[model samples]
Target: MIRSFAVAAIMAAIMAAIAAPVAAGPIEDAIAGSWRKPADKARDQYRHPAQTLKFLGVKPGQTVVEVSPGGGWYTEILAPAMKGNGKYVAGLANPLASVNAAKSVENFKTKYADKAIYGDIGIGTFGKGVADIVEPGSADVVLTFRNVHNWHMSGWDQEAFNAFFKALKPGGTLGVVEHRLPEGRPDADMKKSGYMKVSYVKMLAEKAGFKLAGSSEVNANPKDTKDYADGVWTLPPTFAKGDVDRAKFAAIGESDRMTLKFVKPK
Candidate 1:
């Protein structure tokens, strides 16, 4: 009897071990879902969406707010991932305030009009105020990608961080993915260029009452030299030069990016 019990216990342990990865299937399936466009899929190599989301500890059933989900790039992935069990809030710039912002919001609405996939998705306006976009202490995870530089350029970086802090509950996570400048790059340069120094971003977040929880290099591209004619816009996806050495920029792939995670203290 004892021998049989030992064998059964070991078998159960092995099965549980195997089930661990299987249990993570929902997130992986959502990423690979048919709803994604071919172009979006092609960028996965540089974006590292799966690994980045995993690193951010994003899971189903959690309320997630994506700040400035411009063009709904991440929205396409996040909405499906949170489809049945979780909630996704796309906090956009107030469309009423800017023509460009209006276009972005309209595009997002058109993209996710399908109730079967994105009916539960919420819309909020940010960039002007905290409560205007997301409710205070309501989000489990707040994410922003490649947007801090714009905020800094507009002299709203501190306010943006403070808004993020207010939106997240105590112990909530903030995930940031931004084009990275070399360590010694000046703050003034970041205002004009899209790339930002990781240290500066961290300092701003700290000032907004967030603790630097961790950072990941999953999106880093070492080949990028950070001296492009148009800064980060010189890289692929933007190629602001308009076919000027397009192949050269393509070969370099995307800009080196810093993936940072910050947490509001309980």
Candidate 2:
């Protein structure tokens, strides 16, 4: 009996020690805590915050920016998450993205009041079609989720990628999550299917003077078939098919996504 009791005590001590080293700090707490009961239902369709932020390497006392914070999905979590020491900025696309920016700002303020910080999410048109908002080298990390395909469709992939690279401080991290296509797919496939070629994304980042840090399967969907007929939009989160074949898609869940972390050169 005594030996069993001692073993249990030792196990408890080891667990606590492991947890202590990686305990979520103020920023992480604020970010994760924002998803309370009411919001939990919707979060299932959103990117998993724990996995996404972990891959982004979000830490307390750092400055982070979320690009095109559509519908304030991530903004709702990032504001209070960085309250005590870190700062959270929502960098929306310029005049084109004003409607999105205003909506995000209002939602964030209602959720966090002034505890969360914000910057000029509105920037006028720049060379060609680039946004001239966020300042250069102003952030520690910039994250964009599931928005790259839209940019590619609009022919602003390189422009947006370069903007992210220029806006971060030397050695700042850029985290990208996009619907992914299988290797060797045609460029035409990207347009039909939401999945982008991983090589294309890497080359774009490298050309922007950023280094590939790492990648994760946190959001990968194995069932994705990478076909032209019904690309990523065929999946649940998008469900472009809408009751056409609900059961088949319900089994597939979300689109297969690539989660990559890149860093701007120092």
Best by lDDT: 1
- Find the number of clashing residue pairs for candidate 2: 2
Which 10-residue window in model 2 sums to the lowest lDDT?
119-128
Clashing pairs in 2: 30-81, 31-81
Candidate 1 per-residue lDDT over residues 64-97, each given as its tens digit: 9999888788888888888888899999878888
Candidate 2, superposed: residue stretches over 4 Å from native? 1-24, 31-46, 96-128
Clashing pairs in 1: none
Deviation of model 2 at 104, angstroms: 7.6
Give TM per candidate: 0.90, 0.78
**Candidate 2 residues 1-266, lDDT tens each?**
99999999999999989878677665456454534445544544546777788778987577888876666766656666666667777765443447764565555445545443432222222222554436778789988888888888878789888888888899999999998988877788887678898898999899989999999988887787767367778777567888988888877777788999999988
